[model samples]
Target: MALTVDKLMNDERFSGDNVLQFLLYLPFGILLLVVRLLLALVLWVASIILPNKSGVRQMLSTLACWTFGVYVKLKGTRDPRCSVMVANYVSCLDSLAASHVLGTISLRKWKVPPFFASTLGIRNAAQFVRKQHFAECPSKPVLLQPEGGPTNGKGLLKFTDWPCPLGNRVQPVAISVERMFTNVTVHGGDSRSSFPWADALWFLCTPVTVYSLRLLPPVERHDDDDAAMANNLSAAIAEALQIERTEFKWEELRPRGRAPPSRRAGGAGDVTTLARQVKEVLPAVPIHDILRDLAKTRSVDVTITNFLEGVTPYTPEDTTEPRPSTSKPRYVTPAPTGVFPKSAKERQLSFQERKAQMIAEAKKRYIEKNGLNLALNNC
Candidate 1:
């Protein structure tokens, strides 16, 4: 889907002259930068003097959203009384996108590196750092990005080991960057490297567009007990964002090979009692008939080894048919951190060798078990 109207605006027919149009955008770009910087400075000052005040911040954020030709559509409820909010990261525009939805103050990490320092939006966010005197504000709802950086829609970053001192209930807000307006003139990669101030005026006036925010239901944790609440809240946020838990794919998280003896037959005897009930209710059917029916009806693999306690040899010829060929697994290499490796040889290495070896190994295991691949080829 075309996320923004700029796709239509960029067509040559919209702008009269191809060569002169580029020149026209040059001045407008500078104007956008100036406006954004000035507004950011003003907000920073306001945050210091009147720390709890959010009216001006909300107004500016709303204006920024409007300047970008973005409209926020808030779903679900946001309690006016709530103090904490958390969300998924998409782009720098996420803060502006969530402005009207909750009118909450967005939280950023303690330090934003110098490379990303030029962003007026990010600069405006610096006041909320925990060390600052302004951080004590009681009225403002703290907005947090658990992932800590933009993902560019490739996939979600894991949230299992978040390092924040969370409150009772976290409002999980999901911001989808439906589209972006790319200024081809600024060829730099990533938001941090690019001069956000350079094209600010053009973005402000030219209507650089984005879409809305979808707020999921608020998640609450009652107990202060660490073990019970930690995984529960993590799982809740993952479910709300439609993030898969298996994405972690670590050894500890994977299902165990077999039930323990206690679970299987003795101690609690839950499994034994269930087995007895099943034996009483279900008729004794031959294993071959069940296997054949499953092979014909289901896409999953359920051989004799999958069910029976004792090993029985079932050769290829013994089976009625061959299994369908599955596609190769795809391993997506994470984007380069933009730092060069120590040597030229490192630069020459393929992504599989440089960063994706572990991911490839995991993909191989997944493919072996499920007859599916999740790897993507390099562009």
Candidate 2:
């Protein structure tokens, strides 16, 4: 269906008596514009009187989310060390969702300079701009939609050439719309039918909507060079946004293909090895003891045998046939007993490796089971 703006400007839907309808809408349009402006003024006053930090912004965002009937679901932990968040541009709802759930700062690229300048929410949003860093102001996590505008639920060209500094590690987020609509006069307007205004209202008035924040693991900042950091940050954001890394197709918006293997090959492998080594080192721990410890302080159910089975060195040829039974009577080995890993780094490294390996294996299985035929046919 054509949008209201398009119907008014291009299609002659607004011709004849429609002109009268347009005239009727003029007053409501003016009223909305005024209310928006007042709200913006209030936000400006609040920013001046209250703290100019993420907490205030988040509280305001939560209120806005409630006002719009939006609920935010945060999946993973936000890296406490990092101060930046990057996400896919789905709708204007992303701003409210991100602010409320992540408690991080958000930013948007507007077609017009004064787009939301009159709304208190927008006024508060302006504080996240990258240029306002000199006022002893902490830079809020900026949310960019790169797409710049909405499309027909189709993700389009949204990334730009502007260099984003890596002064803060960025947490990539994905925003998905559970339900949405456009141009049915939930409120009234003739020219207010474009995506910008229509979407803003949908985000403002919807009764119930859900937003999910899938936080990818954070990347370390290794360099001080802005250019290099920006490039790295862009790459990280692209990965977080699930942009196709191998092919440069902007039209295909859905995440396609498996994540490329890490450039630091031995690094990820080291994690797997460490996990296996820890299991081997503590082989004397009884399965019950290990399981009890995991149940109390962790969620892992993996036993020493299972852990060893996963990371034990094996060759492709080893999978050619099953092992032959020995002549001796079969015997079940007793569980090992030993002290657990003590170093925090060692424990963390082992856990991360196991998680990464599981993710990789899952992806591999999915690709193998589905294959290229399914992807092309489904698409």
Candidate 3:
């Protein structure tokens, strides 16, 4: 396990394709996108005369896999026959992965012009509401990331206030993503957090991504209480990813123990010796495969088990296999707006609370504007 996670992430070689992987698959991704567009147009025109439905959706699903050259393996039991699909969020690519097996993605909440919405099937595929409420199983199977945004794939974040709002009985789907050899996984905790395209680029540019689609046994309203069922489903996903469990919110899980600063201040350090020591404990599997499972599900509880405080310093030792990295775009993901969040409890705000927060922000802006106006008048 000399292959520390940080090294693979920073080495710059494993950033998806070498000259070959990109030249080979980037064209495919682009070509398939063109094909997808052309086919969608043809299907739209044909829908006018054709009595049967156009198969554009099925085509989109298939093209997603071909475009990336990255393989997808969807396992476990699933029957959209049950209605709604609840999934664990990892990357935005989860939708593409689902499209391979399911139909058109839920257009989400994008407000497209009427012309585009009709042609692209956005009108029929989208869903928007103040709150997700109880409903019958959707006939066409609606996919929802109840967690709202993506996570590191190590543990489950706090679920939005479902409380059985969107039907008490639901099928939980775990969409686990493995980003070959990188430590960072796809995530979108909030708008200020990370963008989907940026994460997708990092994933696509990486060597390969293994997606595990685990469809859990359906949890019915009558079978268990809402909280219990959610816990069970979350635990099932955690077991699949081989990570620990956490029911707490994102910011609540940082501290280790009630120890002095001298005792715990060294968490962030250049612990090469510690890296070597902890490397010994990593599972005796290929780092690539280990990363796949880790991306699928590595719990936050164990996120600190190996490294001290800061990331373990990494340096590559020459290997037998020839390297495959040169002139790739140096991926630069920006930091969040502020170095730290304004509040610990605000990360998981509810719909109403979020609206209130937005209103307060607007009022603050107006007050500042008026204050500046009065100051100018006085001057």
Q: Residues 1-379, candidate 2: write the lDDT tens digits.
A: 3222222111121323445655666676556556655665665566457664567766556545544556777787777656656565555556667766654544323333332331223322323234343234444454544333332232233343222342346566655556432221221221111335655654443335676677877655575554454345446545555443221222222212423324434634534543454344455444344443332212122223223333212222222367777775323333434545699997797677667666655655676787744442242
Residues 24-104, candidate 1, lDDT per residue (tens digit)? 665876676567667656644544554334565565555545545556677677765456677765555566566555656
Q: Give the TM-score of candidate 1.
A: 0.42
Highest lDDT model number: 3
Q: Better model by TM-score, 1 or 2?
A: 1
| RMSD vs true structure, all candidates | 24.9, 26.5, 23.3
Report the number of clashing residue pairs per model: 11, 12, 10
Return the TM-score for each candidate structure.
Answer: 0.42, 0.40, 0.46
What is the descending lDDT order? 3, 1, 2
lDDT measured at residue 73 in model 3 versus the true structure, 0 to 100: 78
Model 2 misplaced stretches (Cα beyond 4 Å): 1-59, 111-139, 151-158, 161-163, 166-168, 180-195, 220-379
TM accuracy, model 3: 0.46
